[model samples]
Target: MLGIKEIEAIIPHRHPFLLIDCVEELEPGVRAVGYKCVTFHEDFFRGHFPQEPVMPGVLIIEALAQVGAVSILSVEENKGKVAYFGGINSAKFRRKVVPGDRLRLECEIIKQKGPVGIGRATATVDGKVAVTAELTFMIG
Candidate 1:
């Protein structure tokens, strides 16, 4: 299990930009679980929609990717390597996420060869899936 402080050691995100709040689990090259709290004060909310603010779908995927990055970086073999968003496939937004919602982000490693890795990720709010995606990253 990894907390916010431990997670920060692996990723550089911080403040309103740091989408991940905690890592509940880390299975090295296998899987990871991360958490994030969405709030109304987020800068993007103002532009995404002022009246009926809905969390942007891209940011949700970004949060999931951050979780995947944490999982990759925490592995001792991958230390000092950076994970870059290589591509996204099959990404979909299922439900609306708003302020005060706690997002549970999970990622599982599908395959990895050399610097390229692929994973499946999902974000859930209140036990209901909010977003899902197939993400690829270059971790080297």
Candidate 2:
């Protein structure tokens, strides 16, 4: 498992923006599984909806992307490089993610050609899927 510090060493995300909490599984340039412990303390909860805060779908997608980043960036040749979103396709949000939920994120590189690739990603809460997407990334 890789903690926040170890994740930081591989990617460029910082506090607040760094959505993933820890990586439970990883295969450099192949796939990764990570988690995000959502809480009421999240800054976005303040303005997203005061009465009933919900983790934004975009942020959920970003969290999944971060997991994909870790998978690709962990490759020796890709070390220190940043993975930028080339595109997000077929994203579907099935359930609302709220505070206290432990978000499980998984991403597998489905295809790659040079620095560009596609990943199959998903985010789940408990045992149910919260979101799923096909992400395209460019290593820079």
lDDT of 1 by residue, 1-140 (tens): 67777877887777677788889888877789989888888899998899999989999999999899988887898876778999999998999999999999999989998889999999999999999999999975
**For every candidate structure, what is the RMSD over all alpha carbons to the true structure, in angstroms?**
1.2, 0.5
Indicate the residue-level lDDT of 3 in model 1. 75
Candidates in order, TM-scores: namely 0.94, 0.99
Each candidate structure's count of clashing pairs = 0, 0
Per-residue alpha-carbon lDDT of model 2 for 33-82, expressed as tens digits? 99999999999999989999999999999999999999999999999999
- Alpha-carbon shift of residue 74 in model 2 (angstroms): 0.4
Q: Lowest-lDDT window of 10 residues in candidate 2?
A: 45-54
Give the winner by lDDT.
2
Distance (Å) between predicted and true CA of 116, model 2?
0.4
